[model samples]
Target: MSTHSISLLLVGIEGSEFRLAAEMARANGADVSTADTVDAALTHLRTHGADLVMIDICLDAISFLERMRSERLSAPVIACGIDAPARLAVAAIHAGARDYLPLPPEAELIAAAIQTFANRMAAPIEIEALVGHTVADVERELILQTLERCHGNRTSASTILGISVRTMRNKLRTFIEAGIPVSPAA
Candidate 1:
């Protein structure tokens, strides 16, 4: 388990359900905050920085998610909706949601989601400490790992890393310029 506490933002969630979810998250070792609107969520995010965001499906979740991404809120988002249409769920994902859950979310699921996010958020820190590496070193290692996993195919690695092939090439160039050895493409 990570020593760092996981912070979570809940958008447009209220009532007894919100209370229960908040309690469950706290019990699972998370610090949680709430927002009633997109603007409020953004404000909370700017001030507190969340590892994960849970947006109520009723709050025009797709739009909120798009706005968050536009604002560079990199936290993984979870859309919580009640019997939402498949189209709506797909739209939410396209808008940058990492997961979608039914309304009145189950406590176990919420805890699991938070745990997953926490693990993701803790990874870089753990890597850095374990290897005594800088951010660039970690990034280079990750890119190389992805490239290897993709069989040295730049396009596939870039796609998996959510970067353009051009960007991947540029990063590789930087590594080469720094005299870092990289395996040739297969």
Candidate 2:
């Protein structure tokens, strides 16, 4: 958890990974709350404050983000989904999510997110990388990094990125055609 007693809200459909997130956050020393619907989450937010909110991307995440913005909710939200597509993840980011949490949540990843949000810091984001960069640019950069991290294995990269192998191939082709060097397959 982030520090001690940091409050966290996990909102999503019933039986989703949100439950695990709540458990993990709680186990990590956070005061965790759960809401099965966006409306309920918003209602709670209307009266309570949270250090971080982990919302399911499938739960009309964009609408929820818009509502949060309209309601002036300041809690940082991390969108979570099981095998969510890269496009949807990007859309969530564009809609105001600070980050996307991969489903079957990785323990360390969730912990790091909790710590970052609770501390009111975003060190993993590297703001210097976002300076005046377009979303497509960032997307491309991420794909390349994932590819490298996977030792040029497209399948592994696609899985990590929550994108289809076909999409990965297409992006790699595009990058290559654009003269952007991709690591040779290993």
Candidate 3:
């Protein structure tokens, strides 16, 4: 796919990683925008059309993905961070991200990830992607159990899960991952 065919939103609090991602995106020919906060990123999504988002979930921006899915943003998102937890990565994909990659990512990896997300976004959501007893299901169950222990208080749940609130938010995305269908009752 041509990079010009897609718009990329690069989000992270002010830092070198954000700059690196933006530069890589530009080199790949993707029209790119930078957002310092999840709120700003959401505004950009509302005002401008983006094909994908490269996010630093380390800054606790995972909830932004959940909110995006909850709001029904059609564009695919990709979470990028260094040493991001497996749960967070899974949650991001579940929340509707086409993929996730570790930060300090190679330029080619970023480009490829973007291309893959673009391709996937162009297709219809496939129910077969959600099969019996997926890893997402197990993680969601764990998260729900933790939430119940915390009495639905996300802060407490995050503490119990040993992750940041942003990571917790990303985990919530798994509940909405395409055809996964994690219900409130689950």
Instruction: Give the lDDT of residue 180 in candidate 1.
Output: 84
Off by over 4 Å in 3: 1-3, 117-186
How should the candidates be ordered by lDDT, best one leading?
A: 2, 1, 3
Query: Which candidate ranks first by TM-score, i.e. highest?
Result: 1
Model 2 poorest 10 in a row by lDDT: 116-125
Model 2, 89-153: lDDT tens per residue?
A: 99887677878888988778877886766666423557796989999999999999999998999
CA lDDT, every model vs. true structure: 0.79, 0.83, 0.73
RMSD of each: 5.3, 7.9, 11.0
Candidate 2 error regions (>4 Å): 1-3, 121-186
Residue 1, candidate 2: C-alpha displacement in angstroms: 6.5
Whole-model lDDT for model 2 versus the true structure? 0.83
Per-residue lDDT, model 2, residue 20, is 80
Clashing pairs in 2: none
